[model samples]
Target: MLDVLKPVTSLKLSTKPRGEGAVFKLHYRATFVFIMGCCILVTATQYIGDPIECLPDKDSIPQKVIDTYCYITSTYTLPKYYNMKVGVEVPHWGLGPEMAEDEKVYHNYYIWVPYMLFIQAISFYVPHWIWKAIQTDKVYTILMGLDNRSLDEAEKKDKENLLVKYLALHLHTHNVWAVKYIVCEILNFVNVLVQISITNAFLGGEFTNYGPKVASFLWQDPEDRTDPMYEVFPRVTKCKFWKYGPSGTVQKHDALCVLALNIINEKIYVILWFWLIILSVISALALLYRVLTMVSPSFRARILRQHGGTLRPSPLDPSARDAVDSLVHRCQYGDWYLLHSLGRSMNNLTFLDVLRALDRELNRSHSSDYDLNEKNLLKGKDVTSV
Candidate 1:
């Protein structure tokens, strides 16, 4: 019975060419534009269709559209190891209320914990991959616990990084402590394995078992008083009629589930999962490569000498020379900091000396005898025998 009704109930958006000419075929593209616009309007006024909260228009349309694309792509790309049913396949309620309403809800806490945790984990962990893609922000370092050290003593501050000697000096190795990287790797690995299993069920690189999600606002009325509201969208009233009837067994009602499932089945849920899985897998691979290298002793010692840079600086290669040149260049470029400090020392400068120098520059001076304060002085020659 469902198999027959399902086709008609499912919405299809397609158009065929009428009385074909090459010029007329161009008109088909125009029809797609109209189809899209109508979809937007029809979807905009989506009418969650349930009586509980008569939404102004369906808010979940965009979400549904996203789900649809995801389902189509996933099923089209990999079909065997997947099923898109809400409660049956996922063992969890559909996200949007409308969709799940037609479906049933499990109220038992024990049954719901794993399902809820799965959803929460994915939602919490996805941002790492997205953030990693754009982490090239400027950074600054501060040398803390500063005790006085002369230039000669400062040279010894450069210690052989023993940690790197024990392991590889790779940034990827060091970043293992980051929680986001670890989680992203695990999720992504799971995602890829699932995708491959699904693809195995397909043949000729083509997929066909995929079907669209179901959408409904099915509910029965609260009272069986031969209500006329039951005539319109009879599904809702049917449930209500049972609840408020002679047999009077208490039952749970969920209008939100119906609307949510409608959107979910339409395509939003699959899309979110598909992309999230992609992000996870990519993150995992990056972390795995880093981990494998960082734990290696030979790689670690080689890496430590660069002090957080590249691997190719050896005795025979010009890289050492190039790096030394760069180091010299960097020191030369910023000689002003050193030069200013040197100048300060040469002038026997302190904080007070800096202030006095600035005052002298402003023509607000102290006596040349170095015994008089500046603010108390008149013009220079007034104190002198002019």
Candidate 2:
């Protein structure tokens, strides 16, 4: 089992350049790995151990037949008997008399849990896959090994100059690229909410409140409390099978089943419930941060300045400050996003230098355009005079 999980654990720990934020990584890497681990653990336990065992009332009925029948056909519990005294009123908390009025809450979902978790792991990773598809190593291609501090000074400067020229040529071109990434982030938030709803429905609506009820159960006095885990995933259930007696009359056989798998299941679900809740909150905050950076130019400027280590108490020179503000105003959101990603990979000083060089390039391009337009106007005036 440990051998099976080693690759997944290593994948989660693998280091790479920061193409995504911590929250984004949390969705694709940490959560996906954790859910996959759960799926493997549950699958191992289901296959390697006795998931369900049943005891029949009749000695004539073979144990193997009863066990197989109960496991496949399904086992159930009476919810109304849960609070009854174990020994006197009912055989167990959820097992009792088969009255027509009593509700038969079936325990069929356990068999599908491992498969559901596997599907969920894949779902968690979908947004990241979409991001990678759209991103297409654009940042990596642009950086071109400049992120490495081991590069000699001349090589690094050459790469920086090339990158500056590329930025100048592609000004305002990254808006769609940046929007695609933000859409992926939004998809992450949507995925969590959708999974929560799906899992709740799968668990027969117990999953939505599973975490809160468990917390309440923990704080209550032990003497007065009923175990919510049992309510959600009963350890004992009842199974009914029909057989023919010696006289050829149909006889109903009731068996008490012990679902050992529920012990693992309850714990897995508790962890998932709380983790999803935390993810939803943090993902929302990440979306809000993106929104602020998009709508508020001052916020975007402050973020850029901070990234370049220019937001200290010591103010920048008047010309430098104006240059930074002008760059922020002239560039689209995509340009700022690409720069931010680049800043994360490059050293603080190197990133600031790149920013200054790109700003100069942009200014030069603008000045050349203005000069060409002026010359055209002068020629037009000369033609009119002639």
Candidate 3:
């Protein structure tokens, strides 16, 4: 019997399209925008435009003299590493000889990092784009029909009937859409985790591994730590010359050059790792809450009752209330949440309230129609008796 009546009941409860709002919007899109902006900003600044600065070996007098002599003899230029073109050779302070020509110098700071960020931003947006592409047009069509607020009572009653039908159809037939939306939300969190992992893959091991190192820097007395804990970006530690002094002499000089950009990258990435972790945790909790709400009868009933009381000063009509309750019971958490989220976008109202009002109007319209029909039937009977 329920299987037969379900469609008919839904038809009676059908509603009009609602106003366009935040129903289709998501927070991940905003995050994607922020990340893209960060990438652009870094690129525009030329990775903070910090140069590599190197000096003579101050501790070794002989090396200092050698450096001064070399500087005077050769063309003095800022240390730069072009592939195959040898710059200044940076000597290892404690051990090892100078850097070789075949050894790659690491001056590509602004090159890969910014591009990686741009890619990460795009990755973050993919799931959000997919979700919107799948659901937005359909939701827009559904919500658009509910926007005709100036209808007469008769028309409004008819609209409510239509809404009931739509809701019934959504609950029964379109459940897969709701499930897919929920899966998208889960994927969003998974994407974030994957992004973090990709970053960690570059950063030695765990993203949090840097935590202890950072903490040591934060708390350790500055006097106790003689050397800087972190290295700068575009670290140019050594230089080599393929040809020197017109003799075609091969020369290698071990020098120290540091860029200021590394400090900025370190601080930014540490903050980002923590921020993503928090975001993932929050996303997981929200998904759990939604699942619980959809599956737990007690919770659904409570929300319905609470929402009903808030929607009306007087107690809700029993049958109307039951119908609203059934709506929650039959729908998945994702579907219910979609309605809830849309209602929240409109402040101080719930979707169940919309249903209750529509149901009441529908009842009134039916009663009036029934009363008029009865009067006409009585008039016909009277005429026949005469």
Candidate 4:
């Protein structure tokens, strides 16, 4: 039984790029793996054993035929009978005689669960795929092997110089790249919301309230308690089949079916509901953080300062503090974002060195421009005087 889940389990264990944050990875990695694992587990249970078995009112009818019929067609339970005493008022909590006007809560979702879960898992991963497709490896490429600590000193300095030069040349060009990642984060949040809506609809609108109802179920008195899992995913349901008798008379056969699959399904859905709620909250916070970082220069500066503080516990000199502030103010959001990412990957001292070198490069370029403008003005005055 455990062997059946190896493939799904492996997906969760596989290493992924560290470019994304934990919440972002949760959508594509943890949540995707979880849903796919459930899909596989349910699918395995479906194929390995009978997911549904029915006892027909007429013993003459073959049990196999009834089970097959009930499994293919949907099953339903009487909501009114769910609270009735078992083996007295009703033979079972949800089992009772058919009525013309009684409302039926159908068990149609069980059979389609595996397929629906597969689709959901894919949906969760689509945003990650879009991010991967649109995002450039510019940050990784520009680091130029500086992230590797094994390089010889001369080679390391060469790489650092190249990185500083590249950053100085392309200071503000990465805003689009940053925006693309932010768009993907927004998509992840939207995907979770859409999945929640779709799952609610797919499960007959029981999913939205599933978590709270299940939580409240534990507090109710034993006699008054009704299993919410049973309500959404009933263990037993009713299925009716019609056939012609031997004498050419119509016969209606009602079979009480035990839906074995719902045992696994209820647990799966409940866990999924809570997981999605948490994911949505975290994703929203991540987006909010992104917005704060984009609009507030102080937040961006604080983050860079914190990153530096983490790498080197020693306080920055006054000049270094000023350099950090200048870099944050001079660079666009995209450039700052790339620098932050670079800080995470590069060696602490090397990252700080890159920052100092890049600052000097920027200052040198500005000074050169000032000198050139001065020389041009002096040449114009000389020409006019002549």
Separate clash counts for every candidate: 41, 0, 33, 0
User: Deviation in angstroms for 360 in model 1?
Assistant: 41
Per-residue lDDT of model 4, residues 162-268, tens digit only: 99999999989989888888888899999999999999999889999999999999899987788889988988889998999999999998888988888889999
Candidate with the larger TM-score of 1 and 2: 2
**Which 10-residue window in model 3 sums to the lowest lDDT?**
13-22
* TM-score of candidate 1 against the unseen true structure: 0.26
Over the stretch 250-346, how does candidate 3's per-residue lDDT look in tens digits? 5444555443445556666666766677777877776786588767866765655554345433365565457556556655665565555444332
Judged by whole-model lDDT over C-alpha atoms, candidate 4 comes out at: 0.86
Clashing residue pairs in candidate 2 are none
On a 0 to 100 scale, what is the lDDT of residue 54 in model 4? 93
Ordered from best to worst lDDT, the candidate numbers read 2, 4, 3, 1
Ranking by TM-score: 4, 2, 3, 1
RMSD of each: 24.1, 2.4, 14.0, 2.2
Q: Return whichever of 2 and 3 wins on lDDT.
A: 2
List model 2 lDDT by residue over 1-386, tens digit each. 67767767667443455367789999998899999898887766535478888998888898889989998888899878888877788878888777888888898888889899999999999998888877888888898997898999999899999999999899889998888899999999999999999999999999989999999999999877888999888888899999999999999988998888888899999999999999999999999999999999898888877874544323645555565678899999999899888888887778877888888889999999999999999999999999
The local distance difference test score of model 2 is 0.86
- Show where candidate 3 strays beyond 4 Å: 1-27, 50-110, 145-162, 225-241, 303-323, 330-338, 347-352, 357-386
TM-score winner: 4
How many steric overlaps does candidate 3 have? Answer: 33
